[model samples]
Target: MEERQKIKVGISIGDLNGIGCEVVLKTFEDSRMLDFCTPIIFASNKTISYQKSELGLEINYNGIQEASKALEGKINVVNVWREIPAINFGEATKEGGDYAIKSLKAAVTALKNGEVDVLVTAPINKNNIQAEDFKFPGHTDYLAQELEGESLMFMVTDELKVGLLTDHIAVKDVAQAITPELIKSKVATIEKSLKIDFGISKPKIALLGINPHSGDNGIIGQEDDAILKPVIKEISESGTLVYGPYSADSFFGSDGFKKFDAILAAYHDQGLIPFKTLSFGKGVNYTAGLNKVRTSPDHGTAYEIAGKGKADHSSFKEAVFTAIEIFRNREEFTELTANPLKKSRLKREFR
Candidate 1:
């Protein structure tokens, strides 16, 4: 097999009070990981050393002033802060939130400047990571502002791919939020992502209904029949193959989810609940439709296990690998698109 050029992966240290640093350190502990990509951690070396001392983890890394200084075959730490802040495990402190933003902004700037090829962020406390400069719900919204294209939260694994029609919104507001324009935009973004990012030439997407039993043909509620059905019909007729407004209740349980390339859920919990259940805590939260690649673990900061050294790094590892893979896929897609005749066999599905 030919050795591919190592991708420069920018890492953000999320919620210092939580297990963000723990999982990140653990993921890169094995030196063999360097064979795939050069990692530039966007946090002070002091911060990482503190976490390592508490957790008893060790890994050799290079400390650099910027992402451009990162070297292949070594882990690089880009000092985003000068002072070593307090480390209060299992607590959400104001310092934690502020530092998380600092790391994030630095990494994003690196991405924008093309110093880093892709990004894999650790978990951040949504409630605490809110302030004047960063008032968005989570990473997706923040990245949408910093990067190009409409951001869609796509939780994915090998077998199942789930996306949200509405993420990080209240259930009460969901009904009003699910408009025809919104559905078309989200679907179009997801479809484009499927083809370019996942390398699926002809993608088929499934849409889960909003109400119970998909409104039971308007017997329960009219949102599914009145809003979702008409929009789906119009989109399908316009040429992108689509299915559903399928009853959300039986879609995953009946194995109906596996039949399509992707599943679009009506809201946050509607999509994520089933996705987490099916993925078994190994899913990667990919920010689709962005010009630059960014992904993170589906699970948030595990505060309870923050300093216990028991935080499972599987999801975090997958996040890193997924971002790297998507970067390669986009390159392949571009190459294939340039050669129109060879586009027929572009690449395999995300699964």
Candidate 2:
């Protein structure tokens, strides 16, 4: 494993028309960030220069053709594309989507090839990013297929952590998606991620009910009692410390969420609404349960404030810091757990 300070972070430049470049520039503008990790941005020099000119922020970045050549204590820009697409801030354009995918693909390739240590993605307009090559709903879906594990959209802050069982789905379809298999799978994913990524052992997890009031004992809906309750009990009995089927409405509002290490919600909005409300600018959208680490800002491409110099870079900065932290945590975890069983067996044989 590389040294903690030598972690190379690969960044995918998201929608050119949005605030991706703006916040990215703002993040690395502070030289102190370089002390932790080396950053390699996947975009053309022309695009970064133009964004710099627009934001009127002065920063220096080294130009590199590949992520392997990234320099320490300096921001590196990899030229994924030479032709500069038209930047239409405050608007979603096809070109913006096109370039966003290009950057993401390049960064993913580097990640798989071990050119970079971890990846921090910028927000993309999901509607505009639809194409044959990229048909998934969001980053989690795409990364799940490309990476090695089942991905969970975990929104996290220092005080709270919330993961979704089903993300980027319509409200009407959420109930049916909450099956026993899915519940177990998400629980396992969140549990493993908590142990390895966040370094939490014996993690206590809470699950929000799919139906309101947890189905009110089948008065409102049967899914919660018929499905969630039984499955959660089964998991808890297996020594995981899992519990729930709690009413979603009162869980966060009543401070019930503070009791656990993490909470798993049934669907997208149920988990995100409270998370954003409580920790919007400070939260990071971490794609947990993957082999490699990836994180993004909780906020999206704020087209309304795009290119106006009013965009807040706090979430993006947190995303970068979180990615670096998780990368180091994973390495440390691997070292500590490596060959434990083998050593145990060897001791018995020697005795």
Candidate 3:
């Protein structure tokens, strides 16, 4: 088999004062990671040096101005911002968020220009990152608008995959957002992602109910029966293997989610709460249905743990690996889909 070319992975330092630097540095400490892909971190050398000193890490990164100049066998750092911001750890400052957006903006520009093959982002403070440049709720929403593609906030672990139907919306507004059209679109995105990004040819999906006990047969709410049931039925009739508006409370407790390839949650907390409870530091938040690759650690910027050198880099490392795997899977899928006649003829032969 021919060896594939190394992919260039872009890194965005989330909140400068947060544990983003810690995890990013810890993850790249093992130089062997360079063999798989070239990592171009969109953070200043000053920031990285400060983090290394604070964490007492001896890891070294090659500083480069351009992502294209990133070298193999070494970690690369790009100075997104030249000015040194005050390093106030554990505090939610506007300066932290400003530099975080700067790093993200530069890395995103590189991603768009094909300077990077995939992007693995560290955690950011949503509140502080909220400004004129970044008015969106979070990275997924921002990336969706920037890339002109619909994004599904898909959380992935070894055992389970959960995709949110309505992301960053309030609990009170979730019921109103649970429409048939939204359900169908999100489920379709999940289906496509499973096939192309995950290499799952025929994905079995379970949709969690919006209300308690699946609306208790319309006693508590009507969305589960009226909207969810009809939509799942329609999607199933279209040859998709989707089932259930399963009650959220008992679904995971009964291990019901293990039966399907992925679960589509009605809203953010409905799916993410259970997912985080089950997986915690093991999950990767994958932005599915996008034309480009983007993944982040399931957890947030751990302000309490920032600068303590206690931050777990497991999820961040997993995010990088997952991004690479998904990118490879997408490439293979594109090649496989490029020849329709060949696929049709092969299907006839198998039949």
Candidate 4:
């Protein structure tokens, strides 16, 4: 049999105190992961060892300094930190937060240098990580600055994909951020992401309104009519399939969302509330429009249920599967785009 193609995937261990380690370890217990890609975990040897001992998992850990040292049947651990404090499950400490950031930075560096095909991050604590040096809201903003690309946070499930225009901002401040340029830029990023990362030829996007009943035609608010409508119109004219400023409240009820491949919300909660409501445990949070592919489980650190082997690895498992699929699709897209004959054959097969 032909050797299975190997794609290098970098993983950043999120808060050591949380279920990040538990889920990550549990997810990799399956040997089948080697069939898709080589997983490179950016974390300390001690941290992983502690988790393995605590969880009573028999997973093998291979310490390596470089990506090329990865071997099949062993989980490669790139020791980014030398000494990590003893972890207290369900507790968030500054040390754990700093360690999480360190892991993330190492993985990102590997990604930018072409050492990895994709990046799958574990969850980190937003509040615990807040400090003088770590000022960014979350991974989205931090990755955006590092990659110098406009990033969009999109939650993915088998049934729906939802993108947020403004994330981690206060609800009161959402209106101020809803300029036409911002909407246009975010939508364009989402469109490009769908086409390039997801291999969608023609993406259908649904845009959600800022107010109830789509601003009730200017009675509730004029931001939809003034900002969103013009932006959507301009994008549509540019040959991108986009519609809406659909009422946020009614969009989920009407099967109106099913018509489009993805939905763009005006702000954070507008998109996430319904998305999390429907896809809390099973959804995967994907950071789109980045130079490298990054995905995480949709749920948070879940400190309340950190240890005890009760954490579900389904989302993390889905995240790994999603990363591999995206990586393969991107490779296929790149190859086909370079060869017209292959592209034509693919189109014919789909048709």
**Candidate that scores best on lDDT:** 1
Residues 1-351, model 2: lDDT tens digits: 664357798999899989999999999888888877799999999999999989998899999898888889999999998886899899999889989999999999999999998999999999999998899787888999999988889999879999999999899999988899999999999999889888888899999999889989999999998899999999998999898889999899999998999999999999999999999899999999899999999988999989988889999989988887788777767777984443111011110
TM-score of candidate 4 to 2 decimals: 0.94
Whichever of 1 and 3 has more TM-score, that candidate is 1
The global C-alpha lDDT for each of the candidates, from Candidate 1 onward, is 0.90, 0.89, 0.89, 0.85
lDDT of 3 by residue, 1-351 (tens): 686678899999999889999999998888767777799999888989988999988898899988989887789999777877898889999999988899998999999999999999998999999897689888998899877567999999869999999999888899898788898899999999999898889999999988899999999988889999999999999999999989999999999999999999988888999999999988999999999999999999889989999999989988988888888878777777885343211111110
| Cα TM-score per model | 0.96, 0.95, 0.95, 0.94
Which candidate would rank higher by lDDT, 1 or 4? 1
Best by TM-score: 1
Residue clash pairs of candidate 3: none
Model 3 Cα displacement at 252 (Å)? 0.4
Over the stretch 165-254, how does candidate 4's per-residue lDDT look in tens digits?
999999999989989889888889999888877777999999999988888889998888988899899989999999997988889887
Where model 1 places Cα greater than 4 Å from the true spot, the runs are 1-4, 340-351
Q: How many residue pairs clash in each candidate?
A: 0, 0, 0, 0
Q: In candidate 1, how many Å is residue 164 off?
A: 0.4
Q: What's the lDDT for residue 107 in model 1?
A: 97
